[model samples]
Target: MKLIISYKLDSIENVIPEKQIEIIKLFSYSKSDFIVRKIIEACNLKHPNLEKIPAYNILKNNLNEIINNCLDSIAEKRLVNNQFDMAIIEVVIIDNGHTLIMKLKDNGIGLGENYLHKLSYPEFKHTKSQEHFKKKEKDYCIGGCGIGLFHLNAKLAKNDAKLYLKSRKEAGATIEISMKKPY
Candidate 1:
């Protein structure tokens, strides 16, 4: 009887872990797309770093999108062409049948105190609060409605997914997006 019980317990443990679904961790902004690439290969024993983005955005296109997102929080924190700083983006992947998870993180001026609740609506204008959202005056920002996060939330819900974001003013922010397999 004890042997049977032990076997049952073992099977239960395995089943629970197996149902974990997916997990992704992103580290920085400069590594935004890079981290996305990393999630694609997280299952491998050795992961290769590939920045194989199409020539359309020229890598600059992606960064521009991120910069635009940042402005919603900072409003006046865009980096100048000469002011060099990389954003942190990390991704962790867990294979759970029809599910995939992606987490993106950045250590830049995060959403302000009032921005947490607004993350579901994570877009704000620099002029809206007399704050600096973009990097600097010289930095060209990407295009966005400042309502990008809303779209993200909608998509996640469609897949019965979860999106988590943590942020603080002048500190940094983290975002986690999980889906039931979006390829």
Candidate 2:
């Protein structure tokens, strides 16, 4: 699947401070299950027939995991002061007759070089350092067992989809998933 148009994360000036705070609060304070429900609801509203699509369960799970990972990254950056005052997560979906593409961009502490290497394999668990895990902060930012991307990649493959990841150490990350439409 060729990505024709790439949308970057919104510029700092374009992000509203109030909305940013609201998003941070929501992610930082709210339960992840609650957040997932909200995300699924939004997706359902946008694609009412999503449940009828082939590999619907896989698609839905992929979307939720990807979004949760993005949110967790943003929350971590906020904790480490690596994120800007206004954080942003931009999700774009496009259906161009033959393929369905979903791209998620976030202004968070991007993946480091070490983490990038582990991301290549589905079996390898990508985890943060001991210090990060020791932090006694909000549960939302703590993230999972470092298997989300691995699972995401495996699931995408099941649906004949591909996952592309691009990131800069301190800048941000962009994840794109594309699969052929089942006609």
What does candidate 2 score in Cα RMSD to the true structure?
Answer: 6.1
Candidate 1, residues 41-155, lDDT tens digits: the string is 4433331322231211122233334433643333223332222243333334444555444445554456566755654643543212333344454443432333556555555
> Which ranges in model 2 have alpha carbons more than 4 Å from their true place?
1-28, 31-49, 82-84, 127-141
Candidate 1: clashing residue pairs, number: 32
- The residue-level lDDT of candidate 1 at 26 comes to 20
Stretches of candidate 1 exceeding 4 Å from the true structure: 1-35, 43-87, 94-100, 121-128, 133-145, 181-183
* Model 2 residue 19 CA deviation in Å: 12
Cα lDDT of model 2 by residue, 54-173, tens digit: 655676766666766766676667667644455567766777777767777877677766676576674685557666667787553445545878777777787777778888766778
